[model samples]
Target chain A: MTVQISDTARPAAAGTSSGRSLRNLTYRPEAGALIGTLGVFVFFAIFGGTHFLASAGTAAWLNVAAELGIIALPVGLLMIAGELDLSVGSVLAASSMTMAIVSGYWGAPMILGIVLALGVGVTAGALNGLIVTRTNVPSFVVTLATLFGMAGLTLGLSRVITGTTSVALNPDPGSKAVFGTLIAGQFEVAILWWIVVALGVGWMLQMTKYGNWILAVGGDKESARAAGIPTNRLKIALYTGSGFGAALVGVIQTILYNGAQVANGQSFVFNSIIAVVVGGVLLTGGYGSVVGIVFGTLTFAIVNQGIYYTGWNSDWASFILGVLILAAVLMNNTFRRLALSHAPRSGKKA
Target chain B: MTQPLLRLTDVGKSFVGTNALEDISLEVHAGQVLCLLGDNGAGKSTLIKILSGFHAPTSGTIEVDGQPVVFKSPRDVSAYGIATVHQFGGTFQLMSVGRSFFVGVEPTKGWGPFKRFDKGLAGEIAVREMQSLGITRVTDGKRLVGSLSGGERQALAIARAVYFGANILILDEPTAALGVKEATHVLRIIMQARAKGVAVIFVTHNVLHAMMVGDHFAVLIHGRKADDFHKGERTREQITDLMAGGEAMADLEAELAALEASAGSTGRS
Candidate 1:
């Protein structure tokens, strides 16, 4: 009986051997994303020439990565918990407009604008959570509705209040230093915020009990609930977290660029998901890591920004993004298969 | 001699106008296995759900330790030391064994917001408990539950319940999907749980499997208790006949023989 059971269960067990060794490196959840990052980096570094490796060139993509990473980390968590938030783009635009109108146009305190802008995001996110949990509608549809709704609201409000779709904000020096300033004259301060978000989210997903709950909920909601895990509450919290993330990015972009535009953030909705997928987080959920997302963000940023340095037509950016996303997913799938196939040489039979 | 850990008196359940269970009376005692036997659609599921607190009995009373209790939900029943391991072991496939073992009631270290899952303690306890259940192959707590065999998963689930202070373990068709060998392992786990003084409600239709570990038996047929007996009071044939609605099978066998005889005549002609 033991032998028969082992024979049946061995294939699944083969790749999941828990010993720490060189062979086990292939089985690390982030292994695929890491390889993809390195592969993309080396490809771009060769084609993008000396300037691409230069500080100014590096900062261009790093800045983009930083903003996207902030949103992608929480988005990744949502995906891992088996949901999607498509309203992040609108949340960004809405928050940006809120800050601009409050602080930039009305001359209110910068802190008040910041707080209100984030408040808009929190409200939108909480609504998203409430609707998703209460109505049993798929989050994809719910967030999609919010996406269009917020976009319209941001555009209409900005037009009515500021008399234009654009509003300018010249933040106080202290606020600029913290939220928008460029470090070393090139790197956006947002990069630091990105790292902090990554670390904090990483700790939450890997070390906390909440992380376990997220994984459980994503893995199998019925089983999780049967085991007495509060699957509904966990999901709502994750949705809200994703909302807060998008809003934070909106605030950062508004401060850094010194203006807000109603139409500026649509690309982020898909881009953050791209970064997350490239980071080796499964779209089906129940699997992923923050480190993988960071790497994915970097990969995406390079592919996005490297085109300018390569002197290619910017028109091909979307085309290349499509190709890169496909290639990254394929690569991740292969690596996952390899990692889950079987352990090498040091054979510990099940 | 002692008060049964759980007692259901004249329990009945109906879902929307359809009766699922009727007049089910049973008692389970610590250190004993009470096997619930029935064929498909025989109200075994409804009875187990009521017992496990997934469904409330529409009539009669459930007494825990001789005191009547109402279980509003599975969590409420679980609070009374009753844990039900479903058919597939009710485990998360993607999660690590340690995580799955301590899932809902995880051990935490630290204070307030800073408190986190104690992975080391969880892993150690999971491995130790599983090993105690004779699942020695699960050496690494980091192993995914998906990789464990059917029998091993059952053992893990049972061990988790035992470790979490589950005094009343209700196993729902645990060996139904397992192979012969795997079934043996599960049977052993049931006996082990019994030995540890846990009152077990083993639910299965397989007479041999039930006979292997059952001290008390209750057979449900068409939502009603057909027979309730001690282990030695009923023979295998008599129990099997009871499950088939007593003499209904004999009538069917005679009909089948007549049909066969007609077919044979037709072929000869």
Candidate 2:
């Protein structure tokens, strides 16, 4: 029996000889997204000229990318774990409205307004988590319900309390400096917050045990449970974290623009997902990276903002965005297939 | 005699007015492989689930080392050194071998907020443990589980169970999906695990494979133990006949003969 086992093991050892060859760099998961990003950047650089590359011109999209990236990070993690958060758009609008109503309309302290705004997001997020877990509904459907539900509530409340659908805020210098100000008069302070969020979430997903739990839960929840991982709690935590991301962006928007609107923030619902997918995060979950998502966000931002700098018809932005996303995803699929097919070097044995 | 590592007496399980398993009794001693053989719907799955703590037996008691123990959950059973490796090896395909090996109980380094999964330690241990199990190709701990062949996945799962201190290992059809060579690899791993004093309950329908490594055998038919014997007490043919439920095979043969006779008469007409 021992000799037979050794003989059977020999084929595997022979196969391993070629398995040691370094996988082609382009076959990495993020390779497609990286190439797509560069392709778009170079295209725009030539067309948009130095103005597009200049600091102020760069911030045009950087500011947009910052807010979207912040939301996308958590959304990307949720996607990687095999869930969705469509309510982020509503959460963004609702939180923004909450801050405006409390500080601008009700004359509350700016700090209180900020707290209330973020609190609303956390509460909504927790509720979303609870309903999905308890009722066993697809998160896409549950969050969709909350998206409209929160949007309606925000509009109704804003009208009832402030007598309008929009409200303005005048934040104190301290609150504005931290959450609302643009660093160096060009970059939005939200960029700093985006970096902070990326680092924190990136570390959590890559370096910690919790990260593995998320991957396991997303990969196969039954298997994860069988392995003794707390699949449900991990999912709920992801939802809550997503909510926090959306809400933080809400607070930033409210403070940066000094106003809020009930109709605003709807675009973020799909945009963040687009950025995450373009970044190489699988929509089905269980595979992705923070760095991939970051690049995806930048790629998305560049395309969305670069069109304006290119002197093209602004109406074609949506069309162009659609094409870019499909191309990026196709490129990603090709690279993944290449990576999975890469064989071993076949001479070495353990 | 030494106490068996695990013993189930008159174990029965039912769900929603259906008895999935009934009056099953078995015992597995340390360093022994008890091959549980059955056909489809013969309650092999139910019996394994009850043993692994995924389901509670509606009747009978489970004893661990001579003490009656009730398992409320898989976690509870795992705490008592019981582990179950399902048919597909229960591995996360997209994860690295090291990450999959140390998934639920990962080792951490650094202080309070700085703590993180110790990848180096996990990789080193995963490769070492797998090599010890005779899987020489899985030297790179970073290889994705999906990239592994079916046999290698089974070896990794079994190695993981033994390394994590599983005294009673329940493998549910670990060799069912593999080709002949891969099945041999899995059988070898089971033998290695048994030599290390782990009690193994190997569930399969393959009489030949079961006869290869099983020291004690139990044939379950319609949720009941139809036969129980030690090595040398039963021949491979008898075990296969038993798994086919002796009299039922005759009934099946009769039904098939009847159908053939009817077809022949019609064709003649």
Candidate 3:
């Protein structure tokens, strides 16, 4: 509910830098993300030459981007709900283990493995949510605690039971075609999953009752509580969604490589957050979109792998990513101010 | 068909170390607006919260339509036709006007996880509710509430309350921070709500607005009632005085007595 109230109609329309108040131009978050996207593409296309546009190269970068983007979608939704899930990595590991132990180890049916994996993810998410909702601690601290606890459990249980940090799986032929196969040689079916999820999440964020409540909780918890939104329940769902996101990623990776690793998905913790924010989500809560997150993830992937295609040092990838995130965020804030300058100005008695 | 919509008998509330309300009693009959006025730090908020079932008073009981009830949450209050519209309007601004209007109890279709909000039904209801409140200008249910004025948000809050079958409403400072125009708009909606036979307990410091809309006025000073009056017994000046602390009146009495003694001494000289 932090609406900027400024009437931009009365401003002097002079085109001078000093005369043109930043308020006159309505810079939307979508606009900023779009512009950043174009900027990154032009920069890479000029420097990286044919490889940046090569279908094989595009697919390779998109493969990584698809994985990151899938998780980012839910993470963005969670951020908008004013909550976080530090335990996503553990959730991913646990989900993969469920699939590995159930199908590969126990020789169970593929459907059972899929169901067990999803169930494990949902349960872990619910537990995190229940603990956070019922407790008075900040979600940052609470989720962080769950993150460490689940990681320990994932590792201990893996070593004691699976007896190794990783598990190799060869899916049944039926399962491979249905859930694991690559489509069109280049695009992983996971990309389609990512795309469908993005569309669905985006629509939900914009159109649904739950979507509105998510923004409300993120914008102000107390106000959402007063509105009788069942903010606690909504937050728990958000956590559960985050867990579900991680689990999906785990399933995709397990299918892609036909294996499960306890150490996988650690990088997602920060990468997903950056993708969400770069896409225009406010860390403070209640702003941004699914499309923006998708663009942000693509931009990151392009920068990460694109650096190598340009024959530059791969180490420069991290540095470039840091810059891109910072720059996109700065522009996003600027756009927010611009978009808001036209609103009805407050503090005026008249 | 009509028993008193809501009743509070010997309702008392205690905080960690202090009694905010002690043996306080009030009744909200249908179609009546009761304004609860108080200075800062008064127990108006506490009283509102209790009526909304946020905090069960340490001692005392409450009744709705002559039926004694114990409420564990605000949802329980809703079952009894009581809803609270706090100062913030308690809405999601990024959400569409329609969605914010029908949160929690949204009309859903399909089955299980695939269930989606019935947008057409929601929009129709939102439009009708808002129109009933005479907010006819807002036609686009898809518009985000962040675009609405402060008064519009308040009216929407009230409309949402009535739409949800709340017969008794507890509004917390509906116009405390609004401008003249927005506040006037809210007053208009309050009048419409009154016409609908809803019992409203309005909590505010604006005696003028209270006099305009409220059928009864109760003033709380330092967690206690300084005075209670109907439209005839209270004035703008009287309510303002009680709100400034009872010490102001005592100081005025002492000054008047000292002046009388000086006048007498001068007459003798």
**Model 3 quality (TM-score):** 0.83
Reference-based lDDT, each prediction: 0.86, 0.86, 0.77
Worst 10 residues of 3 chain A by lDDT: A4-13
Model 3: per-residue Cα lDDT over A17-136, one tens digit each: 234334332333455665676687678877988877676666676777788887888888888887777788778888988788777777788778888888888898888899889996
Give every candidate's TM-score on chain A. 0.91, 0.91, 0.88
Could you give candidate 1's per-residue lDDT for residues A74-162 as a string of tens digits? 98999988899999999999999999999999999999999999999888888898999899999899999999998998899899998
In model 2, what are the clashing residue pairs, if there are any?
A16-A346, A17-A345, A17-A346, A17-A347, A18-A344, A18-A345, A18-A346, A19-A344, A19-A345, A20-A345
DockQ of 2: 0.41
Error of 2 at A71 (Å): 0.3
Per-residue lDDT over B1-269 for candidate 1, one digit per residue giving the tens place of the 0 to 100 score: 99999999999999998989888899999999999999999999999888777888999999999999999988888889999998889887667789889887888999887898998889889989988988777777776677688998899999999998999999999999999999999999999999999999999999999999999999999999999999999999999999987788999999998889898977863
The 10-residue segment with the lowest total lDDT in model 1 chain A = A8-17
Put down candidate 2 lDDT per residue, A238-332, tens digits, no spaces: 88888899899999989989989998789999999999999888788887778778878888888999888888888988898999999989988
Q: What is the lDDT of residue B25 in candidate 3?
A: 72
Interface RMSD of 1: 3.2
